[model samples]
Target: MNDITVFPTIDDIMAAHQRIQPFIHRTPILTSEAINQIAGCEIYFKCENFQKVGAFKARGAANAVMKLTEEQKVNGVATHSSGNHAAALARAASVAGIKSYIVMPSNAPEIKKKAVAGYGGEIIECEPTLIARETTLKEVVARTGAVFIPPYDYLDVIEGQATCALEMWEEGIPFDTVMAPVGGGGLLSGTALTSKYISPKTNVIAGEPEGADDASRSFKAKELIPMVGPKTIADGLLTSLGKINFEIIMEYVDDILTVSEAEIIEAMRLVYERMKIIIEPSCAVPLAALLKNKERFKGQKVGIILSGGNVDLGKLPF
Candidate 1:
């Protein structure tokens, strides 16, 4: 891989912040004194759940679409996602007055599908597998000549994701540790890079579900270990980490903590009950890790990214 793809600079992130500011929501950072007392840590939640398209994926998608060349924009954009990013890219493309082709899993939630279509995305369903998703996306790109805005691996997307952390640094109080869930590792990689660049003393932590713990294994082994048939309630987190994300993670991430299915559910429930906000299972993983290992965060200031609120209430896990 090229150096530019592997190492995204702070300037790239700052540029993305400016580029996407007009298109995406500047989601607020929230804190709960009640929950802080329980966890024994002062916790700040960057509420990306309130972001456009109900996920932090909006930041990356908006940046990617906005950065497209005029010629490329005319041909439109395409991407494959099980959920959030599909809707996000669709929304970004629509806002930019271009078409969006979204290849989604056949088994993706109805709510997500509706969001993609509602934002004017043309949907093509594929089997719920990495190979199938990639194959189907190739077909869509070939047929439409659309620029493929990958969900995580692309440099522009990573830089856009980093803007979330940059905002945390600019808006919130100082934090000793910043945590986010690891799916394809987009958010985690961006968080790690931003933390290292802006707050060198801050440690970046990743929270991954036990059923999809390839990231944890890869971090420990210092190699990429892809996940196969990961069965977790956090549907958004089933994908393996990307190569660029892995590179950034290896250099900047402090540690990865894995949580069980029950712990994830408990965390989700606790956040809803105490914080009075909705978060998808994937968003709850980081808090689950903190709850499981409270001693590590005791007396420390921590930041957690609530990645999305795009949950299908009809198919509730609890």
Candidate 2:
């Protein structure tokens, strides 16, 4: 585990961006007049959906892999994720010419499993439970000497995620608010840190599903709260907030809003209809939250991170 006591600095984040430059994409910002009109706000979408590995997870995975020592690289990298992070880490390891071991739940979407395997990851299937996943990962690491790269808890991962917001800021848009969907809170916390450092006036907000509202609850309680029995269509946002991510979010994020599943699906359909983009349910949470609280953000220039596009198309709600 990384030293969670220390937070990443702007210099650290900048260095991470440089390190992962070759492995990731500088995903474009998109706008839809229709979307802006509906929300009554000028909205800019940071399309990480178009990113390498079809998500921003590539940024953090690449940075963490590149930061590994020669000895560590030889031993390779390992993690447990049933979603984009697993494939991202696998692809990063493949690019770096190192081995990767991904411990995925047996019940993970078949498309996701195939993606990890396609990226050259050796898959280790475990029972569909956190304890099972962690136990399996630990056994794999013990046997293979692979270094564990947590999805959202490590400083390097957070630094890499911060680059997404940094890119948005570099585009010269003076955004009044920046939003990201909170799952494990990697992207949200990183976004908050970058916004606070570069533009403290920019309010950082997070959107979470009503069904999986640990982040919203934790933000209000000002303490770590484990997610229990999350049941949302936003599968990517199901994980509880990490300790490191929670601390940064409490200090930097302005608010967390929860939205209904119907709102999430509606927002997703609107993006697909207006923007002609394919974003997963989790990616739509921020837009859903914004639409739900349109009055609060009226006429404001808002930047929303479209987290990923890696949805199981066959199982899509629309």
Candidate 3:
């Protein structure tokens, strides 16, 4: 739609890097020689789990919020997110010294809800559905006239998400494939754009959980396959890709793969045990895909984006 909304090109992503550098953390790349030797692939991990708000969503949120016009800033901002985006927007709003209204699914994790409030944003609980989230956001926007900062539907946000890839490219290491978990496809779209331009030879892959492979379907069908709602172990990847992201992903992404709940759980345990890093199920999907498709990456350098570390131990099914 609308020529795929050419968002944050490599230049734009680099600018986002500069714009958010003062605010965001350049999360470390965690590596495990042990796993590498066993898996037969050199892996470089962009641990966005170490990022502020515990996810790369903060990068996009912060950039979009900061770009608001003075008038728009004065009116405030609003958004709908299940978790990471909510925390990110709330944090970004606080940094920008503006009021933020976050509408979240009623069933969203309590920890995520609390993060939104902790960042000084007002929260409104909606039905556990995107329709409700959008309805509430529209009402808030119409009433307060706040700028609506979309989660993954906006260009600025996409560019900011791509910055993670831009930063990863700094090592001058060429990857055979760059794999990122897909939810709303914000991260995948950004990663694909960055990889295509920065490392033209690299294949960009989008990882999704089985029973929730909307992006895969969309890519293969070459049309937007909107999932009203999806069920998946990776909560972060429960939504279908956005229209803009679908276009980019369909055209540029090499493949959209799926992993099972068992694979994700094992991946999570592996990361926690071997890498000594905590990651949510959503963040583990990419790694799970890599583990499952080892044959494809055996001799190539692969980059995986561990999207976030925001997991509640008590709620986990151990």
Best model per lDDT: 2
lDDT head-to-head 2 vs 3, winner: 2
- Model 2 over residues 1-318: C-alpha lDDT tens digits? 565477888888888899999899999999999999999999999999999999999999999999999999998999999989999999999999999999999999888899999989999999998899999999999999999999999888988899999999999999999999999999998999899999999999999999999999999999999999999999899888999999999999999999999999999999999999999899999999999999999999999999999877788787
Expressed as tens digits, the lDDT of each residue in 102-157 for candidate 3 is 99889988888888999998998899866898899899999999999888978888
Q: How close is candidate 2 to the true structure, as a TM-score?
A: 0.97
Q: Clashing residue pairs in candidate 2, if any? A: none
How far does residue 275 in candidate 2 sit from its true spot (Å)? 0.6
The 0-to-1 C-alpha lDDT of every candidate, in the order given, reads 0.92, 0.94, 0.87
For candidate 1, list the clashing residue pairs, or say none. Answer: none
**What is the full ranking by TM-score, best candidate first?**
2, 1, 3
- The global Cα lDDT (0 to 1) of model 3 is 0.87
Tell me the deviation in Å of residue 226 in model 2.
Answer: 0.7
- How far does residue 169 in candidate 3 sit from its true spot (Å)? 0.4
Estimated TM-score for each candidate: 0.96, 0.97, 0.96
Top candidate, metric TM-score: 2
Indicate whether candidate 1 or candidate 2 has the larger TM-score: 2
Flag regions of model 1 displaced more than 4 Å.
1-6
Q: Number of clashing pairs, model 3?
A: 0
